[model samples]
Target chain A: MAWYFSGDKAVYLQIMEEIQLRIISGFYPLGTRIPSVRDLAEEARVNPNTMQKALTELERSELVVSQRTAGKFVTCDEKRVTEIRERMSSECMEEFLSRMKKLGFTEKEASEKIGQHCAKNETDPRN
Target chain B: MNEILVCSDLCKNYGQKTALSHLELTLERGKIIGLLGPNGSGKTTLIKLIAGLLVPTYGSLTVGGNRIGVETKKIVSYLPERTYIPEWMKVKDILDFFEDFYSDFSRDRAVEMLTSLNIAVGDKIKTMSKGTKEKVQLILVMSREAELYLLDEPIAGVDPAARDYILRTIITNYNENASIIISTHLITDIEPVLDDVVMIQNGTLRIHASVDEIREKNQMSVDALFREVFRC
Candidate 1:
């Protein structure tokens, strides 16, 4: 219904994606303290119970760790972080390429368009 | 205690009018549920019944394993749609009154919220605007360590920013063991904070389902479903 939720599936899974994105983007960063469930829930405007389930999911994925009463922190594992980042990038590229194909461009042409966009300072050549 | 509120064939009639029909529902603890409906849909009536402001014409409703009475009152913190604080009383005085009236009320927590909201303690209640009054009342209700919170249109008269702040306060203030039922027509604004939704129409229950289930099963936001379900 709002940011971090697409309203197509379970909120905990959506929350998990959000936290993962934060991790992949270094918003949470490696080995840094994450906000409390109450704080995160408030920030997302979601119930703390749902936020707790998401945080627990993050913990199970080894992206976050709870140190007893000290609170939750992002994982210090850099390899896992890089893996998620690459996965997200590939996912985005796949979606973009598919959309480009739907827009009447071949796979090679779509890749060439990306190359062209990267080659020029301006993204659109028509301008 | 596990089930925060339970209504079994609960009916409320006022004179010749039936405000609420036979409604059966149960709310579990640790949930933030939205009591959603259009005008005259018995949303207020249900909230009032839980707040002990009205007597049901027939059937029963229990809150925190106790029927609606003095015992339930002790564990239930209610924020009515209208201002309940005395016009003559100052903000500080209201805190004192709440602390004296409700055992669960924590004056210090109330003071903390008041300070954060930039409300002066000595400011008379009548002098404040409508939105501020709602915020103050919401803070007071959330500060109480009660088992169940019944908020009737908690953000009806507030600006968007203040509405967001009030929802955040509700999320942060309530303990893990507590559950809150917020009744409002502003579905989009309040949709995110809701874990479950209870829809009522024409003095009867329409739907009660978890937000996740609704989303996964219907592939739409609760607001979208609400529009379709209550479409004219």
Candidate 2:
């Protein structure tokens, strides 16, 4: 899918988040070299400088590492990768739960609804 | 730090009608600057001045520390709003013309782009669709290894698909040392690809800032900001 962007946040931050998603999802596996700034910018249809800024931010956050001669690569630290994955998943859960709360559902009721939905999905032939 | 173009207190006049006034802007190398404004707002005037087509009536404008002359013209590739090529020429003929005229013109690169777009070299310009002609013109302009590209409404007359192709071509063709200035009113479509935006209003500079800074500071897209700033 094309990289999604909205008007509310900074484009570089959005790009940074997208790269983080890719790193966590193994689309760019651990220790694998990511695309160059030009390639990523072209793929995302953004300015190359903006892509460079996003990559620089990623490097600062330790999620990506730049070798001197070679290109940038995703960090190979399994613990750090797991930490980021868990953090992102938790953020998603927090947003979902807060939204559910706005709909007047308690935490327990929301979990129960999710459990029922997953059970139904598993039993369906489409699964 | 590498400023490619500088304009200081620049003014342009057409016998009492001021097309530009007291404009000061500096553009760095390696950036894609969006020159945005509504109709009659002097975007074209600024671009023309930079392209060395029209002389400024007052103040100073320079490209790469050189006055707008034969020297600057050699490094500036300009794509006017209209299709400026003769209709009678074939695509191959135009390619040859560009190759003969500009030392930086790369026939191999232009041909590669044409072949990828499935446009035949033998096709006459008059027979091609409007969008195809625009693409051909853009390809020829971009194939040049110029220091700066001044494209006036590159995507304005094309389809959405063609617009995407044009944008991609622009993104991939420019090297790190070269910069581009795309003047158009289509803000949202080109916002993502721009590093900076120079917004003009009624012959004055309204805003000159980075796209990310504008988005972060205003919490709105550059298009929304333009509407708010230029609302009638």
DockQ of all models, two decimals each? 0.72, 0.79
TM-score of each: 0.94, 0.94
In angstroms, give how far residue B110 of model 1 lies from its true place. 0.7
In angstroms, the error of model 1 at A100 is 1.2
Residues A1-127, model 2: lDDT tens digits: 2366898788899999899999998999999999988788888888888889999998998999999889999999989889888998999999989999999999999999999999999999998
Whole-structure CA lDDT of model 2: 0.92
Residue range B36-146, candidate 2, lDDT tens digits: 999999999999999988999999999999999999988999998888889999999999999888999999999999999999999999998888888999999999999
- Consecutive 10-residue window with the lowest summed lDDT within model 1 chain B: B167-176
Scored by TM against the true chain B, the candidates give: 0.97, 0.97
RMSD of each: 2.4, 1.9
Off by over 4 Å in 2: A106-126
Across B88-194, the per-residue lDDT of candidate 1 in tens digits comes to: 99998898888889988888888888898899899899999998999999989988999999989988978888888888888788677888999999987777788
Among incorrect, acceptable, medium and high, the docking class of model 2 is medium
